[model samples]
Target: MDKSLILNRLKNIKNFATDTELANFLNISRSTLSNWYARNSIDYDLLFSKCENNVDINWLLTGNGYNVKNESNVLAEPIESSRKTKDPIYELQRVPVFNLEATMGLVPLVDGNGVDEEKVIDYISIPSMPSCDGAIYASGDSMYPLLKSGDMIAYKRIAVERAQIFFGEMYIVAVKLDDFSTMKTVKFVHQSELGDEYIRLVSHNQHHTPKDVKLSQIAAIGLVRASIRLHN
Candidate 1:
């Protein structure tokens, strides 16, 4: 759908002074709306439902035909109800995409009070996608074949106390090195032959061998939920 037209019409209907007000009316964050504008697509059904019976579906979606200001023939509700019977709208989960440059990276995202409002670059909404806490850009090809550089990795935080190590699974892991500096990487975590005190980080790339790190040095861990690669 053409979000440009839809966004313009929304501003006209609501008499909104800014896009932030429109996002608030839709019960979504400004980042979500900005993402929609950037993607050039939107959930018109979600918009229609939230607009109540004020807007005409045709006008709201395509920006044509009779609208609220045109006449009293607002058919938004009827069309909405009809579509609900045929195809119900599912609420898509919106994941905050945080910029690694903003903080120490994924570690800080899952470490403390969660998402830093200042660090959030944007929000992404995916249909039928798994629940995710936050997302960061994959930098290296350590997990190549399974992941590549610049891929968006959606992850859910693992509590420090209840950190369940699902061995042999992909995770965004952060560890403290011998120099007390933090190292963040995406790899398949395995049980270290060294024993319960450490874990093995494996790479899918054959040339890269698995390495072990002390479990005590682990600072943060997040289970990888989904991966998205945007096309130009």
Candidate 2:
């Protein structure tokens, strides 16, 4: 795709005050944008990440769908007669939400041992969800509009030994460092050219650079099953 087309589309949608503001919003330097324009090449991944939720990914990439998302008409739930009964209480599974700080602190404890549920700060009941071991509140803009800060993500725990990473899927991975641990999304997993195993972490917001983490640093992993976004 031509980078100029994407730049024009972005300009039309945002109508930013200036090019500097647009560059800041996209988290790219002016030189980088100029380079992309000169080469007529689009960084699809970065563009998609920056325009997530607001713009239709299909339209942006292939020009096959509506430019903007129509959230209301997208997934209207079917009305069931049972829902009109006197008692409308639905069965739900309660998943514990752990404190982000404590969850990171507990990464080292997962050296073959399971997560300590004692660190959980609270619990929430969700209906129509698959079996989830725990939940965590998102912390950074790395995931941007699709998963803004404070969004709840339910995940099923995966044993370290039996963990099989699904490339291009989202995951909550705990990385063990010398004195602390951190959590991020796993974008892709593959062996390096030198035959060393590594996993790439990507942010939905393009400003954050993708990181390649060695397999040795991974302490625990969870397969993300569902996400609950609480809008203000």
Candidate 3:
């Protein structure tokens, strides 16, 4: 927010030691530079035109981008930072683990659809985990060894209405059956050879066979992001 600091950063990027040098580079008089410094006001037009590719307008205008020390790119930061900082940007997040069964009571909260946030019974803050909306305990042995019953799985909610997926990824799904029963379980959702109206649910265990059900049958869906297995 300090225009003077921004102007100083520009000076550092240009390797200009003094206000007179920067003023000459900006095609402005030293007095004009002093005037801007007095008011802490900078003419951004001169920077964009004069500096062009050398100035990283993002870092120049707002101190939001990476802090770079390299002279080659100057203000511009590479995709990857060679220098290491404290990584203050990364922080631990408390993901809500709901009481809902991984199979039955699983509700889509990624979009939070109609579900209330208060449904969260507990929070699990694990470092270096993917971002997710909530977590649920797997209800059945359908997924077996990979994701046994009672394993707490963090899930990212997704709109199951006209669901889009990268076939074969594990997901928690709520499906309405022909018997008017609702089934919620975690399984790999694969494109149904049965056609567009249906999706095949594949269980990890060999004993359980893949079943193709209508996409319309899926009432709610959540992409399984990470799982926590605890044994007593």
Candidate 4:
């Protein structure tokens, strides 16, 4: 596959945006954009869905495919059944995982597998795992000694019942920045003896120092119930 052709197509169809500008618009960094420049081809469905319609998938993927929206119609649930189930109650659903790779430089998973979200495999339902909105496969040795890259960590969303908790507790937290969401393991946020509030997070590895994040920036929190690491 000719990647330069796709890049050239992207440049021509970029609507006055530079490559970096186009990448950021697609919620991907410049480096990631550069990395894809060498690929022979790409899965248009997955890539375009993540890009959120900023670029023409057909043109960016297959050089000859036209830029057109593909739509399909499907049958809806029975009207009578839908009407009867008006008072729907939602239990804690599948875990929500933020993309750390394309969006950030976190762990990368198998892309374009087209896995079904509804396919609840028994492997994902271990009783030892904590109840969470979802699980995230950890990346990097930043949390080494405790968590390794590709370890599946279970998490529970922070809520009223979970707020006002004490320090030293291990939790999965989404750190919201001015432009991005960073996921990290949090130990606790507390006020020092001087009355200054500090967010303190620990590193499992001895080489890395503990980090202090501001309390005001914690977007969401979830308790870490269990983690499963791969042997190989």
Candidate 5:
């Protein structure tokens, strides 16, 4: 394997789990996981399957920051930049659908667990990413103007970013400190007087109080990308 790929694989390992958790997830038993670490390298396939779709393999290997070409590359046009069909009225028929679940309480419109190919829902094929386990449904108005109750939100599992505060981007975050609940909203992370960092998960709606938390407390973070409102 190239030196860059090796590095990227290691970076992905860092995101998958704590050392112990990774060991458990791989079913390697602690001793074996330790052995692999001690050897300074791991099997390519073993590390590859463990990564979430959002992880940039190129970045992992050589710091190129290149995202893997999503599965859409083979069967469909590029997302976001796909051209509209010449015949606007020609709509695609029902596509296979999956029932997804939002383990976190905030976004409720997401499809939760279960896919029945015979029962197609909509035809918009979403390219799965390493981070994207499935879609989430919006549950509350906490993310009002940007997202509302019943709106389906696309979520991608991502490595937790502790230092950056993406002002407008919405995220599905597990606050490791306060109840460890997952909430969907805009967030900001700042420092406190005691040399600690605070995370503020906010709602666009003015009346809702922002959730303020400490950095050492976060468990996971998922970046929100797009959503589809089912209108009759």
Candidate 6:
């Protein structure tokens, strides 16, 4: 699809007056939208699902039909009926969810030439989260209220060279200690008094104290993008 055409359609939608508004309407980040524009590739299925009955699919796909559904078609439906419908499976992307406790052993399989698809214990479908390579179940209360145990966190892999951590952002980092590997949130990163770089792992629960870790101990890093919590 033409990038300009998609952007124009999005801009014309009601309440999507700004890029940020459009991103929110689509349930994605502004950076994700920027990346789409950069690649000139928009996930049209996701766009259509989000727009639902508000947009004319034919027009959206070919630019040859009315922008909105016909008035008669709208009136034919019961006024009390909800316009929302479940998105088709094809429109949703499935991501593998790995067990945090077992991820250390799984890392070698993932870092190999091919990921061992069998290592994935389960899959979660997310229609709105963008650029997620996989997900991990939050293990401890380290992130507490922000990310509780059992919450599924969508993440995107960070290249070794580009693994620089943003000071305040939450990240799923795999650290290699002398005896074992573990995943934890890197809450802060800064230089020490002697100028050596260090990262602070913080827990939202006040009972847990923050620990400093060296960059060299990190084996892999994934930027936490979106999270889902299941409520009883």
Question: Largest lDDT belongs to which candidate?
Answer: 1
Candidate 5 wrongly placed segments (more than 4 Å): 1-124, 127-131, 163-168, 176-196
What residue pairs are clashing in model 2?
Answer: none
Query: How much lDDT does each candidate structure score?
Result: 0.66, 0.59, 0.65, 0.47, 0.47, 0.58
User: What would the per-residue lDDT of candidate 5 be over residues 58-134, giving only the tens digit for each residue?
Assistant: 54554333333342212422233244421111121112322333333322221221233333244344443222333
Which 10 residues in a row give candidate 4 its minimum summed lDDT? 71-80
Q: Which regions of candidate 1 fall more than 4 Å away from where they truly are?
A: 1-90, 101-114, 160-163, 178-180
Per-residue lDDT over 22-82 for candidate 2, one digit per residue giving the tens place of the 0 to 100 score: 6787798988877877889867788878888577676555444344565221122222234
lDDT string for model 6 (1-232, tens) is 5685566555443323246767787788999998887889888788878767656676556544344565211112112223352111222455677755655522412211223566677777755444345687777676777778878887755432222355566777777755566655534333334335566666667778877777667666666767999998
Looking at model 3, which ten-residue stretch has the lowest summed lDDT?
69-78
* TM-score, structure 5 vs. true: 0.50
Per residue, candidate 3 scores C-alpha lDDT tens digits across 123-224 of 787755544556888877889899888899987655453434668899988787644457778999998888888889999998999999887677667778
Instruction: Evaluate model 6: give its lDDT.
Output: 0.58
TM-score of 1: 0.55
Candidate 4 RMSD computed on C-alpha atoms after optimal superposition onto the true structure: 15.6
Q: What are the per-model C-alpha RMSD values against the true structure? A: 16.0, 18.7, 18.0, 15.6, 9.0, 13.5
| Candidate 1: C-alpha RMSD after superposition | 16.0
Tell me the lDDT of model 2 at 119.
71
If the candidates were sorted by their TM-score against the true structure, best first, what order would they fall in? 1, 3, 6, 2, 5, 4
lDDT of model 6, residue 71: 21
Better of 2 and 6 by lDDT: 2
